[model samples]
Target: MAAGTYQNWRDVADLAMDAIAKDPDAWGDAGAGKNCRSRLIYLYNRRTGQLVRTQIVIQLSAHQSGKSNRIITAYPRGHQC
Candidate 1:
């Protein structure tokens, strides 16, 4: 949604999932009271027509028994990758 052109939340979710399936360009701890970790992926922004850096934050403890992780947020950065 930060890109200002996605059709809906579903579209953003799809992109986020794709990014998660690949190796992250960068990643690190998300600090206290936030998701357990964060990852940065370089992805093509359809609206901007450029490769943008997207951030995906995962909350590992949100799910039952740690069976899966929850995406706290996913958005395209204002700058290009």
Candidate 2:
């Protein structure tokens, strides 16, 4: 049976966690500021059922007031700017 349209949330959460644990610098090195954003990329391959170690590019945002940031959006780097 089919469910809602947001089933991939789990996958994304997993990826985000993995990225954070694997490469904390990738997100923190993007820039410096209370309202800065960062990107984390990982290669995904279905044939081997594993990441190709390339880059997925997950864009996240930060705020000056709050201690936490939010995910603005994500995209395939080659497909977008």
- Regions of model 1 farther than 4 Å from truth: 1-9, 33-68, 79-81
Clashes of each: 0, 4
Write the residue-wise lDDT of candidate 1 on 1-81 in tens digits. 435443466775665555554644444445443333334544456676776545543322233353336555555544322
Model 2 lDDT at residue 46: 38
Task: Give candidate 2 misplaced runs (Cα > 4 Å).
Answer: 1-18, 27-53, 64-66, 78-81
Residue 33 of model 1 has an lDDT of 37
Number of clashes in model 2?
A: 4
Clashing residue pairs in candidate 1, if any? none
Q: Write the per-residue lDDT of candidate 2 for residues 1-81, one digit (tens) a residue.
A: 001323264565566545644554444423444232234555455345465454444454554564535544443343212
TM-score of 2: 0.38
- RMSD (Å) of each candidate, 1 decimal: 5.6, 7.2
For residue 33, give model 1's deviation from the true position in Å: 4.7
